[model samples]
Target: MAKSTHDHGAAFRAGYVALIGRPNAGKSTLLNRLVGEKIAAVSNKPQTTRFKILGIVNRPEGQIVLVDTPGVHKPGYELNRRMMAAVHDALLGVDLVCLIRDASVSTGHGDRFTLDLVKQSDKPALLLLNKTDNLADKSKLLPLIEWYQQEHSWRAIVPISALKGDQIQELLDEIIEHIPVGEQLFSEDEFTDQPMRVLAAEIVREKILEVTGEEIPYVTAVVTEKWEEVREDFTRIYCAIFVERGSQKKIIIGHGAQRLKQIGIRARRDIEKMLGHRCHLELFVKVEEDWRDKERLLDQLGVGKEG
Candidate 1:
């Protein structure tokens, strides 16, 4: 329950805050809700966020810079190792840590892995029991909160539904309280720090996550090859979707290229909405022979230390 002694309400506050939890625990959804925009791509699939994405929330009184990271999971591949590294790096130099838990489901080993990371951090940690709307019994929340309070002396334990916009403002107020007194970390007009190329890749990857299920989800990665502004009102974007095997590529393309068409159509719409411009998007499928393990390819995709 350790926290700053400064009067946060009396002074302007600004600092970095990280959202960490088990896979599919609604951490990305909660980040989007707090930032008031879809800065992070979310899917029903686990491990959707592959890197640490920064989102800014500017309030009337304080500013919070949210570092949205990949879900906590065991590393079975080089890609998975890079993802876990992002989580460790985000833990450094943060004012507060908000560990979200999927309240609707029973806690398990993955949840324990996240809790252990929290125990190692010296920052003030806040436990957000997200997706409480899915709970059948509202009375179950009290015991849930009490149990977590004993687990870790959190600054606050708040129940919220990030999807249904329930108690969102209350969570924001609690977050502002934990931030220390300082100047604004980012400008008032900015919402996220993600570059255009990375966001395009993420948007395309989100479509892939939604369109394809099974083993295809983990074997896929998107790279934006070209981003050209044809005119002030128009943009032409081309991206390549890399898979480890040719069969995987064929599955993604589908019969008569129907599935690829579907992915492109859905992804283009999201890209247009995000960029606020008319977009012409082209998607191509390629077999990279396990590109995730290749350090050279991963650096190009923005996962290396210098990347």
Candidate 2:
């Protein structure tokens, strides 16, 4: 990752900055943009981010570890209950908190739920009105900002387009000021802390989310079963996509395994680019009989993992 040249002799400041919002509220996009890497899983589908994704942003003044959490929403399944737990955990012991809201969407119960969390934090928090580009009337922003202003006293509020990279520099400028002075937490060159196996599974899961529709993506979980790096330039990974029932397995594998093959082909391209190694990606479908409800599998999925 390329970083802006900063005066190395100057004081270094770094700390954790949590990005919280409702589902599909652009938290992943903002993390990717701020960190200058595609490490987080992103999809139009809700809850694309299931756990805390750590992204390191290196600036001359300081390094910011962006903590991306699963969107805040009412829990239905055991997995969702764990996701909400992650959101609460991320808010604790963080140097800063950023509540990212989709400016295009109207304020509702979900937004209020997130805002309530922000108010509870009572720490240095920034309200990011994200996806401002999607707003049909730019003038509507003033009222939206006013509403949040009335809701809580924020350190700063900035409207940005995470997808378009609009006003991001301004956002960064604001973020750095709030981060306390300290030494860099991570090496400047490092972009993410996720291991290759977890990332590989996430890449496959992202592809699954993109390829499938309805409840299939939500019902699915990808686990890396094997990773072989026998050669300097070649690697092989085997992953199992777990579903609740055999019928869901069929949906993922498709007829004659064509859909699964497509998933592998597409995922390998991204895996190779991210790892800079030729990867032989293999995927398998398995029915885990409601694996989301199984506590053991949840542990393997990085649930209850810290930021």
Candidate 3:
């Protein structure tokens, strides 16, 4: 990462922007695009982001610190409650809010619920109709945009495709324009606030989401128990995959432990890329018996921790 050479004069602007929306609404994807890095994990699964990840974007005019939060959903467990808390915390400490919605899907109660959250925030917000590239009938966007406008007096309504880099620069420009004038909060070289251990655990968890089915991903959590740099170019990592039931553990391990093996291989590749060094990843599956409801474990994992 390089330091910012951008001007920091009277015209400069900077602020935190929260990415809020329902599950699987492309919030993580949009964050990655805006920050120009994969600091946040990406998966098709809903609630893929369990914690709020901050990614810093340095530009000529301003710096945008993006808070990528977990998908908004009803709380059913301690974990869910904490995730929602993270969302609320982000809403309280931000200069702007971005309500990202999947335009391809028909509007429903869930969408309205998300909008209600934005309304309660009472902050300047931009309604981003994401996944516009996936819309088969582009004409339908007009009605969708109209509906959002009618719901709230948005600062701006921009239809975008977070996956395809569509209108990303325009969105950035809009963000910088709306934020208040201020000095940059972080240095240019800083991209994300996530620690390397947390990132490694997230990458391993993302691999679990990618390799397994829906049930496994939601019921599973990965924690990096050990990280050691044995050499300048080689690192060793050990992660524990916690599951709620023994049967689920069997599923993740798979026949002859091949599934777990595959997950290790996939996660190591990304971890190595992130570390810029060779990595030896070790994984172990453990049955935690409904760890999502355990407060101590959640504390250790830093889930729902205050920003």
Return the lDDT, model 2, position 122.
73
lDDT of each: 0.86, 0.87, 0.90
Better of 1 and 2 by TM-score: 1
Determine the C-alpha RMSD for candidate 2 after optimal superposition of all C-alphas: 3.4
- Candidate 1, residues 106-174, lDDT tens digits: the string is 878888889889879878989988898998897777777877877888888878899998878788888
> Backbone clashes per model, in order?
0, 0, 0
In terms of lDDT, model 3 sits at 0.90
Candidate 2 residue pairs that clash: none
lDDT of 2 at 275: 80
Off by over 4 Å in 1: 1-9, 304-307
Q: Candidate 3, which ten residues in sequence have the lowest lDDT sum?
A: 1-10
How would you encode candidate 2's per-residue C-alpha lDDT over 1-307 as one tens digit per residue? 1123333465768989999999999999999999888888899999888888899999888899999999999988888888888889889868999999999989999999899997797779999999989988888888898899898888888889999998898788778878888998888778898888888899999999989988897789988999999699999999988899998888899999888988999899999998898989989888878777777777775655552
Q: List TM-scores for all candidates, in order.
A: 0.95, 0.94, 0.96
Candidate 1 lDDT score at position 167: 79
Tens-digit lDDT track of model 3 for 53-84? 99999988889999999999998999999999
